[model samples]
Target: MKHLRFLNKYFYKYKWWIIPGIFFVVISNFFGVIPAQVIGHAFNLITENIQIYRLFNGFERATVIYDIFSYSLFYFGMLVLILYLLRGLFLFFMRQTIILMSRHIEFDMKNEIYAHYQKLSLGFYRRNNTGDLMNRATEDVNRVRMYVGPAIMYTINTAVLFILVIYAMFSVNVTLALWCLLPLPVLVLIIYFVNTLINQKSEQIQEQLSKLSSFVQERFSGIRVIKSYVREDYTKEIFAAESQGYKDNAMGLVKVQALFYPTMLLLVGLSTILTVYIGGIQVIDGAITPGNIAEFIVYVNQLTFPVTMLGWVTTLIQRASASQKRINEFLQLKPDITSKNTESARLKGNIKFEHVNFTYPDTGIQALRDVSFEIGQGQFIAIIGRTGSGKSTLANLIMRMYDIDSGNITVDGNPLKGLNLNNYRNQIGFVPQEVFLFSDTIKNNIAFGLDQVTDEEVSTAAKNAAVYHNIVDFEHKFETMLGERGITLSGGQKQRVSIARALIKEPALLVFDDCLSAVDTRTEEEILRNLSKIMKDKTSILIAHRISTIKNADKIIVLDQGKIIEQGNHEQLLQQNGAYAEMYQNQLLEEENQSL
Candidate 1:
């Protein structure tokens, strides 16, 4: 219930529906209970007229008595029928308001979770799995909806029906009504005990379901790897084991629920038997008439269904409580990364890192330490480093995916943190080492960053990235759809397509972080030539391992570990005989040897 308080705002938002829904519930039950009174009256009418029929038998006046009997029966019959019809109408209205409100709340909640998922920092994603995130938004939300809809509806329906029916019974004969309700308090106590077990088991089942979904998601995504390694059987065994655990937990709850229903049937049947026995005694004593006994029986039976629904409603509530707790866990989180400024700025791309320092939050590894660099507008700078030498970290910092621990990063002489995060990110074109593309057409993938783009612009960007020839060769050309992560394209083709995605933006600061590792050196050279012309007035930063790729950079920086070991133009680094010169000589010798 504490966790469920989070849903109060949604309830208030849809209050018109809820308010009217409750009204319909009360009205429906009010009409539903009146049928019992009508039945009692019809019984009394027949009982009272029996003497008149006996005295007027076999005579013409007896025809008048018969007409009276016929009209009385017809009147009572029609009244009961009309009452039931009215009850049915209000029942329909009750569902329309309450059930429909639940769907709207569900829509709002899913959108909320998805939007928050996007706003969270990278560390949050690293700490959570996709399946768990998806489960909380979908499955957990569904359970919560049940509580908002059917559970609440039934609970209120039962309560209203109980109240109307019980009051009618007591108004006629209090002592008989009291005896018939003996099992109700006992039913309440039993449901209280059963609800606890339901809550505990429900949480376990949801948790296991999340694990199962995650296992399936990962296995499907890596199915190619599994086939290549021939580990399909092993994965199947693990899946079977997980499925067994889920089934066992589900059966546990089902067993408890299974025992619950029969027990409810027995208790409800006891009330009916008590009404027949005790009311029979009352009628024999002349304390009430036989019609009164018949009415008592009807009242007990009317209360039957609501009493039976008690266990079910409580079970749903317990499960929903468990699920809402899970949902509230994620909803309560505040993202660590937020923009200090909200104003958009046109960037000139003069970026400076003043002794920047950063450590990965998930891991204690410091990716950058005391690193400093500057890139003026229209400068082409290249960072060369061994693997894990803080090159990618520099790119990440420039993109502001994570903030620095100490020191500051400035763009166009303004603090990076002082710019609107979304506005700042929208201006930069960043191509990471591991490229990701959507399962969409080639043209759409190229134009993904923009809301609207011309097909001609897409083609021009592809031509600049050196992937236009490959695309044209396809039967569908730009309209050809890609598989997940662009798996349909070859490695180099995928890299080039990724480059086109960034190139189409024509951004102020364009970064290529080892994004050209798949293409041949000839293609790389051709693309680099195109970049020189297109990015003449923009700030460009290229992080690569190949010496040939960065040799023509305006300024070259070489990194080892987390520090810059050498900095200068190609000639200056070669003359110094430092790490860069060694890498250049080794590459040159390797190329010469390969020619042999």
Candidate 2:
């Protein structure tokens, strides 16, 4: 119940619909209870006429029969029909308003979750599994809708029906009503005890389902690896184990329901038996007529269904509560990275990293230590480093992916924190080491960064990246559709397409983070030559492992073990004969040996 408090705002927003919905439900139940009294009166008319017929001759007996048919039969039939018609009408409106409101609320909640996901930082996604997040977005949202729809409606239905049925029974005979309701307190005790167990089992079931979804997602995404490793049987066994756990948890919930429903029915049966016995004795003692006893039995029967439904409604509430708690956990998260300042300024790419130090969260390992560098506008700078030398970390900081532990980064003399984040990012075009292309047409992929782009712009960017020739050779050319992550394309083609995506943006700052690794040396050189013309007035940062890639740059920086060891032009570094010279010599020797 505490977990449901978050939904209060939605209820208030739709209060007009909800209020009328509740009124219709009450009216339907009011009409539903009247049928019992009408049927009881019909029985009384038949019983009295039969007695009168027995005391009369044939003509008089025929007249009593005719009277019964004319008065009791027609009146009772018409009243029952009218009551049922009104009940149906109200029930229709109840569903139209309340159930429709629930669907709208579901739509709004899902969008809210999606918007929150967009605001979350990259680090949060790295820590969470894709399948788990998806389950919280989809399945958990649906369960909350059940709470707003059927659970609420049925709860009101049960309450209104109970009150009206009890009032009707008390009107007939008070003592018999009290006796028939003896099982209610016991029913309440059962619900209280069983509800606790249901809540626990329901939570366990949802947790297991999330685990199963994650397991399946991982297996499908890595199916190629499993086949190459010849671990099909091993992976299958693991999946079976996860599936079995999910089944066991589901069965546990089913077991609780199995016990709960029967116990409810048993209580209802006890109340019915009590009504029949007590009302029969009262009629036999001449304290009440047969019609009174009949009506009492009808009222007790009406009470039976609502009482029986109590167990089911309790289960729904418990399950919905468990799901709400899971969903609220995600909604409550505050993003680690956000733009605190609203000031906007255009960047000229005069970037400076001042004594920057950063340690990744939860690992305590310093990814960058006192790293400092400066890049002026329209400079061609290259960074060469061994693996884990914080090359990518440097680029990530520039993109504001993570905040530095200590020190400041500035763009165009303005502090990075003071400038608006989106405006700052829009000025830079970045191609990461790992290229990710969406499942869309090649034209769309090239123009992904801009909201409005022409086909001519896409074509020019592709040609500049040295991929247009290959694309034109295909049957569909620019309209060719790509698979997930561009799986259908070669690695080199994907890298070129990624480069084209960034090029089309025409950003003030361009970064290529080992983006040309898959392309051959000749193709890489051709692409870089084409970029030189376009990058004449734009600042460019190129991160590469091969010495040949960066040897022609205006300036090169060499890093090892998260610290800068050397900085010079291509010829100056060779003259110094230091770490950069050693890497250049090693690469030359490897190339000479491969030629042999």
Candidate 3:
């Protein structure tokens, strides 16, 4: 309930619809009660005139009495029919208002959640799974919507109808009303207890269903692996066991729900019997007429559903409250990384790292220590290292994905944290080792980040990345649609496409983190040759293991065990005979052997 208080602003924001819907609910219920009153009056008219009809019997204007009585009943029935029609119309308006408002709120909530997700830092995503995040946005929000829409609607409808019917009952015959309503409170109490049991069983069933779905999804996603391992029988048996569990849970729920309707009917039937018995006594004593008894029966019947719904309405609110609590957990989370400045700052890519130190927060592994370097504007700097030697960590720091634990990183003489985050990132073109492409056309993927791009620009970027021929070979050329994660292309093709995507931006700084690993040396050299023409005045950082890739870099930095080991040009490092020279010699020998 405390967490659900967050929705108060939304309720107030959409109060126009809610207020009108409430009005319509009351108006509809008002019309709804009139039908029972009219039905009672009709009964009275028929009961009173039956004797008069008999008095004129035996062919002495008896036919005239019959005609008058028949017309009177028809008129009263038509009034009841008109009253229900009017009730139905208002009910429709009520749904249009309140239900529609709930939908609007749902839409806004999903967008707000997704926008917040974008604002959260990478650490938050690492701390949570995708499924849980999606459930908070979709499943939980849906439950809250039920509270705002149907639960509220039924609650209001029941309360209003109860008040009107009870008032009418007391006004007619207090004694009969008292007897008729005796079973009602008992009915509510029993239903509440039984309904709680049913809800527990239902939640168990839902849990089993989720497990089944997860099992099936995993099996499908890893079908190839299972088949390769020849574990089809093993997985099949596991699935069968889960299915059995689901059936057992469902059966338990069905059994509990079986008690729901019968209990309601029994209690309602008791109330009805009490109404007739007590009203008969009143009639014999001349305290009330048979019409009064009929009216009491109608009122009891009218109240049967709303009284029964109290338990279900409470259940919905309880579920919604729980769900809203989960939603609030994410909404209240402030990101670890926040931009200190909003204004877009111009940068020329003079990056300096002074005694920077960082550790992976989630894993508690120190990835960089005492890393110091300076890249002047328009410098082609390369970083070479063994696997897990902090090469990518340096790139991540430069991208500002995470802040350092100590020391300062300044870009263009401005503190990295103090500069506009978006402005800084927008000017840099970064191609990660693991490439990801959207399930869209090649042209769109290449031109993804820019709002407006011409076909020529996309083609030029493709050519510069040495993947132009691949595009022209496709059936739809640039318009060819790819499968998930660009699975339709080979690894080298995907990497090249990602390069094209980054190059399309023509950013001030380009960071390629082992992006050309999949391509052959010839293609890699061709790509470097083409890029050199465009990178004449822009800063570039190349992180790679291959010496052939970075031998021509203006300056090279060698890292080992999370610390800088060497820094020099290729010739100077070869003269120094350090780790860089050893890697260069090994690669040169491998290339010579391949040629032989």
Count: clashes, candidate 3: 0
1 versus 3: better lDDT goes to: 1
> In model 1, what is the error at residue 219, expressed in angstroms?
1.1
| Best first by lDDT, ranked | 1, 2, 3
The best-first sequence of candidates by TM-score reads 1, 2, 3
lDDT of each: 0.91, 0.88, 0.87
lDDT of 1 by residue, 365-475 (tens): 999889888899999999998999999989988998898999989998998888888888898888999988899999998998999999899999999999999999999
Clashing pairs in 2: none
Kindly list the per-residue Cα lDDT of model 2 for residues 1-596, writing each as its tens digit: 99989999999999998999999999999999999889888878878877777766477567867776677789898999999899999999999999999998999999999999988887878788889889989998999998899889889999999899888888878888898899989989989999999999889988988988888888887887999999999989998999999899888889988988898888888887888899889889887778877787777777777777788889889999999999899899998778977666766888888988888775677888887888888888899989999888788888888888998899888878677898888878899998999999999999999999998999999999999999999899999999878987999999999999999998889999999899999999999998899888789999999988888888788888778788878999999999999999999999999999
Per-residue alpha-carbon lDDT of candidate 3 for residues 485-547, written as tens digits (9 for 90 to 100): 788899999999999999999999999999999999899999999889888889999999898
lDDT of 1 at 245: 98
User: What TM-score would every model get versus the actual structure?
Assistant: 0.96, 0.96, 0.93
Against the true structure, candidate 3 reaches a TM-score of 0.93
* Comparison by TM-score, 2 against 3, better one: 2
Task: Report residue 589 deviation for candidate 3 (angstroms).
Answer: 3.9
Q: What residue pairs clash in candidate 3, if any at all? A: none
Candidate 1 is scored at a TM of 0.96
Candidate 2 lDDT at 89 equals 95
